[model samples]
Target: MFPNNLAFISSNQLHLVQSSLLSMLKGALHYTIPLTIITFCIGLVLALATALARISGIKILEWIARIYVSAIRGTPLLVQLFIIFYGLPSVHITIGSFPAAIIGFSLNVGAYASEIIRAAILSIPKGQWEAAYSIGMNYSQALRRIVLPQAVRVSVPPLSNTFISLVKDTSLASLILVADLFRKAQEIASTTYQFMLLYVEAAFLYWVICLILSIIQQKLEGRFDKYISK
Candidate 1:
C-alpha cells in the first residue's frame, strides 16, 4: 500500500507539470504572439505619424503629439489597461477585453516609439535635408525617400528591443482576462495547488521566448550592419 501510494503521488506530480507546460505553450501560441504582433504593428503606425508630427513645421500638430506621448508615458500600463477594460464600459462605450489589451498596449508602444523615431530622424545631418531640397525634392518627398530609410536603419535595434519587451509585457493582459501564457499558468496552479512549480515553469517558458527573440534581434542587427557596410 505504501509503494502504491508513492507511485501514485509521483505520477500525479509529473502529470501536473506536463499539463501546465502544455497549456502554457498553447496559450503563448493563441494569445501572446497575436497580441504582440497586432499591437506592435498598429503602434508602429501610430508612432510614425506622431513622430512626423513632432518634427513637422506645424506647431499645433506638434503640441498634440507631445500631449499624447506625455499622457501615455506618464501613466502606469496597469492603470491604463484597467481604464480601457473596465472604465470605458461604464460610459456605454464597450470594448472586448482582448481588444482593450491591444489598444492599451498599442497606445503605450506608440508613445515610446515615437520618441525613438523622432530621435533617429533628428540624427541625420541637416545637410541631407538641404541636399534633397536642392535636388528639387519637396520636404515631403525628401522625407519619404531619403530621410526615412536612414532613420529606419538607426531605429531598428531599439524598436526590436521594444518588441521583445512588449512580448513580456503582454503577460499583464491576464489581469484583464486575456488568457495568455501567464494566465494559463495561473489557472493551472490554482487547480493543482502547485503555484511555485507552475509559476516557475511559466517563467522559464517566458525566458525561452525572450532568449529566442534576443538571438533573432542580434541576427537582424547584424544584417542591418552588413547592409550599411556594403
Candidate 2:
C-alpha cells in the first residue's frame, strides 16, 4: 500500500513538470518568437546604420554614435527596459509592454552589433578601397558592391551569436508584463507554489530553442565559409 502511494506521488510530480513545460513552451512559441524576430530585424538595421555612422568620417555623426554606444554598453539592459517601460510614462510618453521590450532589446543589440560591424568593415584591406577608387567607383558604389559583401561574410558568426543570445534575453520581457515564456512560468509557479520546477521547465524550453539556433548558426557559418575562403 505504501509503495502504491509513493508511485502515485511520483507520477503526479512528473505530470506537473510535463504540463508546466508544455504551457511555457506554448507561450514561447506564440510570444517569444515574434518578440525575438522583430527585435533582431530592427536591431540589425539600427546597428548597421550606427556602424556606418561611426566610420563615415563625419565628426558630428561619429560623436553621437559613439555616445550612444557608450551609454548602452555601460548600462544594464534591465535598467534600460525599465526606463523605456516605466520611466517614459512619467513624461507622458505612453507605450505598450511588447513594443517597449522590442525597443529596449533593439537599442541594446544596436550598440553591441555596431562594434562587431565596425571591426569587420575595418578588417577589409586598405587596398580594396584603393582598388575601388582606381576603378572610378565612389565610396557608396564600392561599399554596396565589394566592401559590404565581404564584411558581411566576416560578421555572420558573431551576429548569429548575438541573435541566439537575443532568444534567451526575450525572457526578460516577462518582467514588463509581456506574456512571454518566463511570465507564463511565473504565473504557474505562483499558483502552484512550484517555482523551481516551473522555472526549470522554462529553462528547458529556452535551452531547446538555443540549441536549435546554434545548429542553424553552424549551417550558416558553413555556407559563409565559401565566400570567406575566396
Candidate 3:
C-alpha cells in the first residue's frame, strides 16, 4: 500500500501543477493581453500629447505637462490602482475592475513615457528644425518626417522596458478578481491545498515569460543600435 499511496500523492501534485498552468495561460489570454495592448496604446497617445505640450511655446501647456508627470511619477502605482478601483465608485461613476485597472496603468505609463519622448525629441539638433523651416516645412510636417522616426528608434529601449514592467504589473489584477495568472494560481492552490507547490510553479511560469520578453528586448535594442550607430 506504500507505493500506491506515494503514487496517489504524486499524481495529485502533477494534476494541480498542470491545472494551474493551463488556467494561468487561459486567464493570461483573456485578461493580460487585452490589458497590455489597451493600456500601451492609450499610454502612447497620451505620452505623445504630453511630450508635445511640454515642448510647446505656450507656458500653460508646459505647466500642465509638468504637473501631470510630477503627480504620476510621485505616486505609487498600487495606490493609484486602489483609488481608481475602490475609491472612484463612491462618486457614483463606477467603472468595472478591468476598465479601472487599464485606466490606471495607462495613466502611469503615459507619465513615464512622456519624459522619454521629450528627451528623444530634444536629442535632435536645433539645426534640424531650422532646416525644416528653411524648406517651408511646418512643425507637424517636420516632426512626422524628420523627428518622430529618429525619436521612436531612440525611445525603443525605454518603451520595451515599460512593456516588460506592464507584464509583471498584471499580477496586481488579482486583487480585483480579474483572473490573471496570479489569480489562477490562487484558485488552484485553494482547490488543491498545495499552496507552495502550485505557487512555485506559477512563479516559474511568470519567470519564463519575463525571460522571453527580456530576450526580445535585447534583440530589439541590438537592431536599434545597428541602425543608430551608423
Please give, for residues 6-38, the per-residue lDDT of candidate 2 as tens digits: 546466667888777777878888889888999
lDDT of each: 0.94, 0.91, 0.87
Query: What is the C-alpha lDDT profile of model 1 across 1-230, one tens digit per residue?
Result: 56875546476777888877878998999999899999999999999999999988799999999999999999999999999999999999889989999999999999999999999999999999999999999999999999999999999999999999999999999999999999999998888888877888888999999999999999999999999999
Sorted by TM-score, highest first, which candidate order results? Answer: 1, 2, 3
Q: In model 1, which residue pairs have backbone atoms overlapping below 3 Å?
A: none
Of candidates 3 and 2, the better by TM-score: 2
**Model 1 TM-score?**
0.94
lDDT of 2 at 90: 100
RMSD of each: 3.5, 2.6, 3.3
* Pairs in steric clash, model 3: none
Off by over 4 Å in 3: 1-9
Q: Locate the minimum summed-lDDT window of 10 residues in model 1.
A: 1-10
TM-score of each: 0.94, 0.94, 0.90
Worst 10 residues of 3 by lDDT: 1-10
> Over 4 Å off in model 1, which ranges?
1-11
Candidate with top lDDT is: 1
